[model samples]
Target: MTAPIPTVFIGGNHEASNYLRELHYGGWVAKNIYYLGASNIIWFGPLRIGGISGIYKSHDYLKGYYEHAPFQGSASRSIYHVRKYEIEKFKKVNSPIDIFTSHDWPEGIERYGNTEQLLRCKPFFRREIENQELGSLPNRTLLSHLKPNWWFSAHLHVGFDAEIQWHGEGSTPYPPADPSKLPSSVPTYPVQVEKNQDEIVLSDLEDNSTDDDSRLAKKPKIDAGGEITNHNEPGCNIPNKEIPVYPPPSTNFYGDSETTKFLALDKCITNRRFLEIIDIDTGSEETKPHTFYYDPEWLAITKCFSKYMSTAQGPDTIPSNIIDEKNPDELEKAKAWVKDNIKDYRILDNFAMTASGPPPKSCNPSTNLNRFNRPKFNDTYLYRNQQTTKYCQMLGIDDPFTAQCPENDTVSK
Candidate 1:
């Protein structure tokens, strides 16, 4: 509440997952503080900020939001894992995104940067980086699909910068004369793939072999003074310390298809300051408004795909790929519904605490050493966060989590 500037965030493992579950559609967690929810897009004047919360796991990624409050077993931790059900709706995104953020780095992102330097810092990462098991596979797919101007992520404790060049179809690595001439339709990712532990095996592996990712790692050179120098990565001025960063122009697939600037920072400590401020020209400087806006398009997409939301803890696969929003008429109807149902597109600045703080550890007593029964965490009751309740009410939908419990009790998996 004491934050002087408007702060926004995405969730990682170290959080109260139950509270985040309540506001699945995203909401103000406290005054001037916003949680991006599971997946969403918001507008601040001309800037379209899109984000997804949580890390990715292959097995759980294909499942639903099965873990409920008063979480038990591995469910407590697994609930924080990323799910494909939430990301499927974004496949319907046809518009451009200005900026996007996630809690973890995109898979194979290390290949696009100073990987050699990274390996020198953390030798343990070499195996995963070599095996292509280091980052989020789904996010890498989204990176190509959305092609936002700027992407930010932090999970691996390091500071790095890289750019992704959106080479077009037919195996081309350059944009055409008129980028708008390029296709706006997103590519369909494999609906089901052979899953290995921490890996999604793609059929197109033969074509991806030439990415020369090792060369990208070799691009970074160290001078005698220990400053970082790039061999071939152009227009990127990666810093040893904080410097003014100017975000490249918003990516226009038909124009400059190679404009995504990816930046990931290390954990800040002692004398190192990782904070960077980029001067963005989001329309006009004279009328720089600071207010939260619900993106109508994102809302429409969410409404159309709400039925695909999963809450099963088992192997119940949600047929989310079957959703066909490509038909222009269907999406238009959803937008019309959003307009008619929601009178004000601007999010009201209301924040409320929906659950009590975690009980003090002193309240927990040690159980019998030989007792193997699951410990009861009945001290806290189920909380139906009203922000989500009211948001769903306006959208002419039920709160996916609370609605399942009906009486505001624990949601049955």
Candidate 2:
């Protein structure tokens, strides 16, 4: 007799929706075992662990949470697929997470490291490689922004490993288009706007005629030496002293160029590479150095979700007074909002297009039994269990999954 080893899991596209929904924030799925549901980030000592549950599809990316149990028509789609608002928590935190996981594979990741080896191993995936549609586009976008040290994914039932090199801030680099089709001069703006939530109130400012306004118009006094002096301040005669300068600080947590080791495991039933044992040196100077800083550009991209989602969802959620004909002022405000959020809307469109290769494939959720509702017990769970039991039998051990014990022995305090 032996104690059962604890296991943790994140849900995939095929899961018991009701069961997962009960412990959405990831309560224990089994004794001493846990589930990391939806978009959850947790910590284990120095290691920061995070995961996004469920598969990705364009339409399902930005909606309020929905789930249905008992495998109803189309209801299971909402129940299993990752929702739009689920990722909001990720946008709020800018810390460098150590590890990340998802159910669906990240799209176009094969191009980063070694595709030759990948194709040689999984020749059946050649079509997906050619079309660049093997994995999730939203996952690619998130991976680019988060730049975690490692990423693990499943659902493809294939054992694969690769390194995805971070290409730095902004979108992935694209090759130049046709010279004739390109613009004569690329549009360049002198000022680049950094987006944030600070507002400057122009109403508070006044012309020079007002007493408060006079302070704004005041000019600094310039001496013969060409050094400017502040005339308004009383203590403006402080002597200057030279201070020691320090070297520029590093802005990396891992002390190395951000690159993620991505691994996808095969099904346990396959009895081949079913699990991976990795050693993460959390205390190493090369890994756990404390100079990590969040990339603000990536944060901005994450925070833009609400703006884009609003546009994609349309003005139905807009206030009735703002959209209704009764109040013209509010209606104008709503219109202005729509116009202002157009940039984010367009950004989302471009992101989806670039990541997924094409628009998301349209399949009827209600009628598409292959894609949505139909569940296979043997493929998902039972077959794996049976295979494990058979393996145990070959080794002359009792089937751990069904080993019987005395009633007194099974009793717990």
Candidate 3:
């Protein structure tokens, strides 16, 4: 009986290298091992940096030392050229090469509408959209010539668990042009050809149907119990009142269009000393706002306004008049309301500050701020104060005011 054909998996880049290393170290001693891509050197270079010359040298070393022949190929090169090279390479070693591997989709797969998006040749808004189809490129001259029984490739990050038959003669649905008007490289060859003058039948495998939309539909559903489930379920009619009611639509202030406008406005603010209060918590900070350091309370209000400007601008912008000067109960209520509703503010003090500049020498909290000629409310100072307040709050210490020195007091050397 013929020995079971050895199988191996190969991929591209550093990820493949790490995977191969794990396989090698895990005692997987398969006689056939292949590395297909440009990044193999990234993995093997460190092992034999000065000692080895090329990939063949490393392969030979592995085979001689570890008793496993290593196959290497560059998928970037022409598939036809690589196939020919592989056949010749295997012939010299007198090894029967049964399988082919690559880090790229076969040519026909690239023709699938979805393949264009995989290569980022086009824009894709949602990840769920199938931008290309599978097995659409086998008709290409290079792939057709090589014609491996089972072609293995990745690069798309898609899974085609089921067998995909090649439909070479089918018309492509993209570019929305007539195929007849397209120029052919060469005359199509007849499928019938006698190798030893013995009649052999070649079946036409192309499925010529423009209705490929069905092939691109969502995959069959599987139930939570891991069994195949019917997707057609009867809809249950329930009272509309029983359904959860959603709140009225609210507008986003820092969305793409607004963000762009804000950036431009920030540039103007940077020119003037008018403060720009940024909500640092949301990772949205304007480098320049219209003045010097503004009050944190004002900054919080600005953030809230920016978040729901459309809604805020519509009549109910300001809250009902409520005063709590010395009333402890009202002050506590106001503090809670501010904390819950307001976004924390951060000031962009130095517009052109850099690490290499004459400021922020060390971020150590205990560093003497007086020695650096930095302002009392510099980023470091403010950050340190914030941290102290946070620590005190976490420790259930209600008096954060004691942790902070007078805000206006400058440190004197």
Candidate 4:
């Protein structure tokens, strides 16, 4: 049976690490469904979509490790957190975005709208919301950076909406100024200014290329005279040398700088109001006005994934360089290493079979685990504390969100 509307999703903190690893660049999950990866932007007709997976964890952001089977304790967290590399790419293409999605809510986003009504709706969050101690710090920072028209999120298991208003002067706060407003000027000498172009030049050291190790096995040898020579050539007696490659460019992490609106969905599996559909007007019309346009900055960001992203491959086999070597002992040793470290690759000929079967008619409230499954408060508090301290130190200020989440008598100490 065919469905009425197409569906798509972004990864949450509890994503299937192996599955996502299989589709790093976001392969199709079903006939018309797709998964948005760690960092990406795509176009559906005229609508431009951008998304970043996972929640924000300080440690996970630091170590953006690739997925491996026999998942470790931090495996889930590592796969789902917003990594420094992803954020760096966003900063590099610093421009306006259309629709953005993250797993967690932005920190202290309550003040952008009616917090009193939000508290009234969900009394259980009275303590956290009133204290301005909910949501994610990294998400808040990203929201300010990528000022999208509409933001969608999940993982907190409660559906809420608010308009995060950006103020004052900035490219993000308002739409691009009317080009017609500029004064006409006399023709001047033609000059060229360097425009930003998208490029991904990965170093050998940081290269996660599927065949990188194989290429390394056949790397040319350097002779004493500083000349690069092949060891396989006749009369060549120099031993093969291993060169230490340098790491990728260091990424700079910055804080939020603008306002944005957000709509966080509840637990889809166990909530009656699981789905929240947003209607966006793509045309420019009054009352039904739609200001969305083709964003080149966002287009540049998506290109990063298109040209250089990695592809999931089968089990590790000995490189052809090792197999084709003249020596027989080298082949045997390589086989032994593979036997000890590599497992038989699981055949996933039909990758779409991994998709969740289909949507249920309704979520049973009797089986809901909201009470027992609430996230820890102290953990959230500690994260906010760390973020606050870091921003304060960086900005040389006592408080970073003083203008946003101001101190009030009713606020928690």
Find the candidate with the highest TM-score and give its number: 1
Structural RMSD, model 3: 32.1
Write candidate 4's Cα lDDT for 172-243 as tens digits.
333322324222232233324221111111223244453322433366545445566442232221111111
TM-score (C-alpha, index-matched) for candidate 1: 0.72
lDDT of model 4 at position 120: 39
lDDT of 1 by residue, 1-413 (tens): 54688887888765667778778899988888888899998766556789999987665665668776577656766787887676667767877787899978887777767776665554456778887667777787687678887899876655778776665543323221132322233224433533322221232333556332344455565544576754333322234211111221122322223467788865444333256787754544455356677777888887866765767654434353444436456567787898677656677787887645444566543542123232444423456677887888877776777644557354333
Order of candidate numbers by TM-score, starting with the best? 1, 2, 4, 3
The TM-score measured for candidate 4 stands at 0.48
Weakest 10 consecutive residues of candidate 1 by summed lDDT:
241-250
Clashes per candidate, residues 3 or more apart or on different chains: 4, 2, 18, 1
Local distance difference test scores for all models: 0.65, 0.47, 0.24, 0.45
User: What is the model-wide C-alpha lDDT for candidate 3?
Assistant: 0.24
Give the per-residue lDDT digits (tens) of candidate 2, residues 13-118: 6565645654444445444455665666644334556788987654445444533224355556545666545543454445576788998888877675456545
* Cα distance off (Å), candidate 2, residue 299: 16
Candidate 4 segments exceeding 4 Å error: 1-4, 120-133, 167-259, 269-271, 284-413
**Which has the greatest lDDT?**
1
Query: Which candidate, 1 or 4, would have the higher lDDT against the true structure?
Result: 1
Candidate 2: regions farther than 4 A off: 1-6, 167-257, 284-413
* RMSD (CA, Å), each prediction: 11.1, 28.0, 32.1, 29.1
